[model samples]
Target: MLLNLLLLQCRAGFESECAAEFMQHCVDVGQSGFPRFDAQSGFVLFELYGDALAVIQAVSFRSLIFTRQWCACLPPFEQLPADDRLSVLLPAMTELPVCAELLAEVPDTTAGRELLPFAGKLASAMAQRLRQQGVMLPRKARADWRMHLFVLSGRHLLLGVSPRRNGSTLEMGIRRLKFPGAAPSRSTLKLEEAWHWFVPRAEWDARLGGGKTAVDLGAAPGGWTWQLVRQGMFVSAVDNGPMAESLMETGQVTHHREDAFGFAPGKPVDWMVCDVADKPARVAELMLQWALQGWCQEMIFNLKLPMKKRYQAVQQCLEEIAEGLEAAGIRFQLSARHLYHDREEITCHLDLRVS
Candidate 1:
């Protein structure tokens, strides 16, 4: 596609935050664009007044926190006849640069879920049509671009393009997981998703395994701790509350009856993970303190977002952390995301070792 606009997917009810962030980023990159989005549309479109190819090249998709998925797009096609929709969809699909992959996606809303059956059928029909048109490569055939068909309803859809390595490979930018029956609480899934998102699989054994040591602050009932233990890492589970007995019997966890905010590891450990429910500023500061003291080489924590000015809160916390690290001459890699398993807060991963 000779794309001129950007379609950004985000969590429903967060369209404003996504729009605000996207606008600021585009401004930073010197790209001018005006945004359009409904209150709960689960998407924001920045119709570019400047060149879109220039804009996407300047603004890395990973730099966006609020946005789940991004694609440079042609304007949406609407009101296709219920029958023979492929005839209408194929023309736009064929005009695109041949993409290595195709994703038929829907908004993460109740209405979108109802169209899942239709989405599947649409994907199959479009793939066959595009194949005949010589516009799409077979799946995983090695190409830089990805094609996305985002469906609003049976009769409406948008065609977009994204760099394969720059954004999520998953459809709809969602990482769905089955909750473990043995896990103590549903909160475990957040940390599990964190590892899945932040860590590349090839480095998992080297960075995440080998009987490494970890500390889980606010680890009562053992949600985050279970993931560490599952990876063969022994954990010092720190919380004032009682832990799940099933985890205790594994002989892998040492439960400490102490306040997480007040506790420190005896020595620097391989990892420190916290899921304490507290103010975002306090949480960011607490994580930084561990970094300054070299208490842990890596840390993952959640910042509970305030109800208002949520985007401002996120930027301030991240900026403070970045400035503190720079002033201390500490080299680090820091990133935050609003993950699928999270609500009202975002997860952060901070590594003291940049490489």
Candidate 2:
């Protein structure tokens, strides 16, 4: 049976691109889904072919917004009441199963040009209508999550709600408003940005649940190590240097006071995480060796970039790493991005498996 599937893509510079890439990746994993076009919203729509909840969970966790683009699929459309259009589509849009009806539909209006009461009514009615259909997510049951709504041009209203940190309204406003004089802010930690960029917490937990272990190279201050330890996993933090007092206190982290290259785990670890201040090629080599030797099941590492040929460097590094891993007959999942947290660098995550 054809089913409606909505994909939530992230916005660039706001770490939304990562979400977008994941959505595209999901498209490639086509057994469970397929893509359709929603020219009305100016975003690609998807036709789900598997579990309704899986589609919702995947897109909800990926996109920063609670965006549900329109798509055409399945039967029983004629049976659905006109008011139930949005509700019928909600369950297929995310991992949640919600049945809602459109309370009202309002025409498009430009921002800063004075929105009519009907516009506000349209949004409010949509919310209330969903509540009536038991579509409202239980707030008391899930206190940690926050939701944001973005009304894009062309009457495209997308939602980006999550149960994570509530982004600052200033930051959100800056991104959405795009004020002319806004300078690119750099106060945000790059590694934190990379965490969200490379791996969402859900996927990270899934990897761990799948029995993934990890090695954190150059884990001095222990920022990255801290994250790993919190995940209830063992970490081999390699560095001749001392770890932060706080990380060492955790006891879950093992400090290998030696060159990361010279050291090897007694057995294969599930992951090898590197945040070293080394040349990109060298970092790539270390990652390749681990994959080629079957040292780890997956890897998330960083490559410090030079001033020149930034894109060229990334391409070259990817090629060399791919060739090396392929020569060793290792099949893997690999991704790289100019993470919001990275400066003059790009981070790579590789999931290596024997399949």
Which candidate comes out best when scored by lDDT? Answer: 1
lDDT (0 to 1) per candidate: 0.87, 0.53
> Once superposed on the true structure, which residue ranges of model 2 sit more than 4 Å away at CA?
1-202, 209-212
- lDDT by residue for model 2 (1-355), tens: 2234443322222222233443554565553454543323323334456643344444433322212122122232234334444565445334322322221211122331243353355456556655655666543444332333333322444333332332221212112222222111231244445555556667766765443467888877676776666666788889887777766776777788989877789898877788888889988888888788888877778888776665557667888898887776778777675543455577787777643
Which prediction has the highest TM-score against the true structure? 1
* Candidate 1 residue pairs in backbone clash: 1-96
Predicted candidate 2, C-alpha RMSD: 11.0
| Shift of residue 287 alpha carbon in model 1, Å | 0.7
Q: Count the backbone clashes (under 3 Å) in each candidate.
A: 1, 16
Q: Which stretch of 10 consecutive residues in model 1 shows the poorest summed lDDT?
A: 51-60
Cα error of candidate 1 at position 266, Å: 1.0
How many times do residue backbones clash in model 2? Answer: 16
In model 1, the Cα lDDT at residue 45 comes to 86
